[model samples]
Target: MTLSAQTKVGPAGLISDLQSLGLRLEDNEVGVTGRRGGAGPSDHKAVSLAGRTVMIPIATVSACESPFVASRPDANGISEIRRNGVVVSHIEFPRQPRFYDLQTTEGIPYSQIATLHSSDVLATTLLQSCIRYGNRNTSCQFCAIGQSLSAGKTILRKTPEQLAEVAKAAVELDNVKHMVMTTGTPNLTDRGAALLCESAEAVKAVVDLPIQGQCEPPDDDIWFERMKAAGIASLGMHLEAITPEVRARIMPGKAGVVLERYMDAFDAAVAVFGRGQVSTYILAGLGDTPDVILSVSEQLITKGVYPFVVPFVPITGTPLENHPAPTPAFMAQILPQLGAMLKKANLLSHDMKAGCAKCGACSALASYEV
Candidate 1:
């Protein structure tokens, strides 16, 4: 039943290890119900697995003072545990970047636009306010993109020049290797892809770092080509949920873009960024059945898109805070299927060149398979 032996284990073993960490399996999804002591959303839960904690929704673990739990034998905020009584340690959480304290000459907060994750890559949402957030009925249920803006923690927009300045400082001072530029949907003809292109061009003006740009697919396929010409090395067009019903329920605003548009975007991006350079995020435990997710992943792979499947760890302040995280068992079942698909497609994470999936910090699926 030992799950982490550098070799894949059965789904049941993954389930057992998660249950040992106080997780529950409901409707074939693994999750837990508890409060981390926050202001809003009292019923939020932490997504823990194999004794390690993933994302705890903002409502669940919002404040820095919130009471959260770490499993025994903690390793720098991550937990470690044994399946079949063989213990394995978890990876360490990367430290917060030092560049956050610095500000641009215009007195703009640098951290407002971008922040570091997993301790190395510099990630930014150039446009903090999403038009979708204005419509309560249509916004992505799991997004807190505008919540930070409402809290006055970030700015409404960031210019390419400002982003370029920050990238320079982050690379020179923090040794950042890669950069991720994502945006809130702007009501524009290019669907925010053009803005990402501008930012990528500016950043490339300062450094030759690997850059990944994510957005809803542009209305025209040609934007993918433009993005590549602008110095963007990779592309991520996230299909958060594969099922139509799930998409409507969890991401009404984003769902309007339709799966066909995302598929088209991915295909065009694959042609521009190349196969392994194009990816999409498929969130687990969002009401999509494993069969459904697997089927969608297969189609995506056939079209040359890497399905970056992540557990649905609800964010606080969002509608899904009360929602649960997918169990290790669920991830284990899906990871092998995804791995086999990738193997057949001749796509590998190591070939991605750079990005979140390439970093392999958010989920253990990449390490478990590739």
Candidate 2:
């Protein structure tokens, strides 16, 4: 149950509550369009709460049962956030980006090439298809990478030229501050690092926005230097679950790469990207306890890697669609201690050049940094 009105929960607690418990929308609150399904953080909408933009789950199964209901926006586009019919705070959704309405010189819609993440970040999937996604035995059960491609919302492959075109427009038209390019693991040793390099290089040539490249650790460490040289400002190599048992059970194909290899990769990447610039994503509520997550996060921070812990919101059509998300209390147990570790290491998310941790929309961990 949420705290009573007599309790004074600050913005951080409110953000965590909104993220973990999700939010319901009133019938008239449909002016803003929420992303239904996509590659990263699917079934969510970007909302501004207490002046901080965050990705809040709205279309998930958990949201259907949430006590937090958002009223329709007033004339000024502000909505009241009520928990159990009592007003707690206010929120505003980001307007549809101007770049989303434009088309490339060749007439392809810019949105198919790239989309807005948070309020001002441009994000794209370099390759929509992954080698393991087609096979259930090897697939990450929570992934929706193929769903967007299958529904014709995005293209299978985004060429360097197309990405550059959309990126430049996103910067000029929508004031996009940075770009994030993640790809499905291809059938190669570089594991899509090569594609990210090509795409980042192209976008940098056309626009000045910082870029973050995310992919599996390449077979060779040299790729990190190449990525930094190609104008990629930061890197993300996600270890979605820390424990081997959970990793194997949740993402069998990814677990094959092993945590030891990831440790070595983080060390090498940190050398190039510099400390806090290298980060990872650890999904909470995947059966790994907060203690285990914090233990691994400490190791990553010691290696100069930022471990971005996020609550797992089950996406539709995936194997775990009906699975429950972590409760707000669960996140409460993790973020405070993790934030203290980050503070001690001086690995502030604001110090990151460009990445998920920097944007910090999908998780409230950043709010606990204070």
Candidate 3:
């Protein structure tokens, strides 16, 4: 059923639609600058709607054919969002960060080291290369982690000093609230913990912003303590797909680690990061039924871990580029139930110190929490 101009949709519904179907810009002026083809919420632009910012997909194939469209921004930097030629809402795009103009003393651009995520979060991939990404049999089918590296949009490795430099400038210039550092799986041993710790420590040395470090479970649980001591305020270990079959089918090599290992790791990391501070990302449109997603989410909440469920976006240049994203109706079924559960557990996205769940831009789950 197509929505007509008379249909009434709230902020949560609008966010869900924009994320799933994406927004087609009627004019190029609306999105003069935005992220494209990189790690951590690629091909998205931060759109401020209903007093909160969201990372809406704008570069996907689905966006080109979406029912939602945005007109050029007025002098006040606000644009009108229309559905079937009916004005539904007005939105604002975050201006390009001030830090993007500066470079390290060595001449490496700060934008190349760390980019602004959501509206105020500074995000960077410590290592652009991933072990699984190099092999088709092992890589996550939905990943485009290598595209930015290949396109020269980002550097392969960001040194601790360089990260600290960019992080400080972002805080001072852009008023960046926190930092999110995610790395591709470097190896099976530390699983990128060592680099995250080093980067966090360096960033903390020069800035006071909170930091979230995301990676696979490290072989030794002691790394959690090391990370906390290094000034990491929160942690994220993503379970992009919940079911074993889907995990194996979508990310075969990652599946080898097994769900048991992830559970154990989550318990240990939660012990270090504290309740509500340790979180996991669950992608909703990746063949997991609502029951399966809710069941896993309940388990995570029981263990005091926040389960952030987001719609699956088919990034271009990846194996699943042609895969269809979840419909707004599909997300509607899950988000409300999950939001109620989080309320019952006293877990809220706003209370989070830093990270994707805290940013709450890639998913509309945050809006439902209210």
Candidate 4:
């Protein structure tokens, strides 16, 4: 028997393959569309590639429909394009965590605080609320943090003990491998980094999984060292956009964090976490040109930071929900250049040791480029 073709392909090819799998991609101002249940014109669903389900609005899909996709989209945009009724390059959807079945002693849902990502990684918004989430003048246009919270799916503040309990259960029952603690910016001296450390320490005391913490650069560079000491194996200080104008328009609140400050934090994190352990997320197709992304990625690689570039897929209820994902052709065009930068700097995703992009689940850029 011959194995199904595993050659890498681009976005257009990915969509075509998915269409052949009985999945349809309906172009909408709200991104790609598909159908899950008994089909009809009104049955088309809006969905996210994150976990690959026909995530129709709550009003559309029956509550009985699986909330998560049985198979997810590959980094190149291919779905289950099977041959001879056998799956190829199958992408597994994250299994819902057992922790979701429990609640904090305070009666808060565990899922509300920190939920599982990629089946084995625990991710949470320590503070579900961001100062930016409410202010159109300040919020990252693409963020749905507040929308999810308002929908009663998550909590605003998660206690350290609560995080510890969930972490313990997730690791023991679900085979969780790592933890990611992120937060909305609080009007405090340490920004959200200090709270992340407290949560990291709490989770560390009970579980031994590698931990990654994401936050803006704090006012003090010393906080990076503090985080490393707190059992965090790696750090993510995201510079979501590369250009000043885009920064201001996309994330007014985060844009206040000067580029120099981020560079400083990246340098500090590298010193503490070692090369390849420090990373930043660069979202392509957010009105940024390939030239700009390549230039910024080159600089990040030179500084010993892994630049994890991903296509910007706008989520529903966010300001950019209507925005289209970057064409796969665009991603393919730039990934080679960005990947070369990684090779030159010796910053490979496998070298990240542990983290989101390192897992190579979100973007196929790593699998293809590396």
Instruction: Please give the clash total of every predicted structure, in order.
Output: 4, 0, 0, 0
Please identify model 2 stretches exceeding 4 Å from their true place. 1-7
TM-score of each: 0.80, 0.97, 0.97, 0.79
**What TM-score, to 2 decimals, does candidate 3 have?**
0.97
Once fitted onto the true fold, the runs of candidate 1 whose alpha carbons sit more than 4 angstroms away are 1-93
lDDT of 4 by residue, 119-140 (tens): 4567777887777668889888
Q: Model 4: clashing residue pairs?
A: none
Score candidate 4 by TM-score against the native. 0.79
- Candidate 3: segments with Cα more than 4 A from true spot: 1-7, 29-31
Worst 10 residues of 4 by lDDT: 35-44
Q: Is candidate 1 or candidate 4 better by TM-score?
A: 1
Clashing pairs in 2: none
Q: Could you give the C-alpha RMSD of every candidate to the true structure, in order shown?
A: 6.8, 2.8, 3.1, 7.7
| Comparing 1 and 4 on lDDT, the stronger one | 1
What C-alpha lDDT values do all the predictions have?
0.67, 0.90, 0.90, 0.66
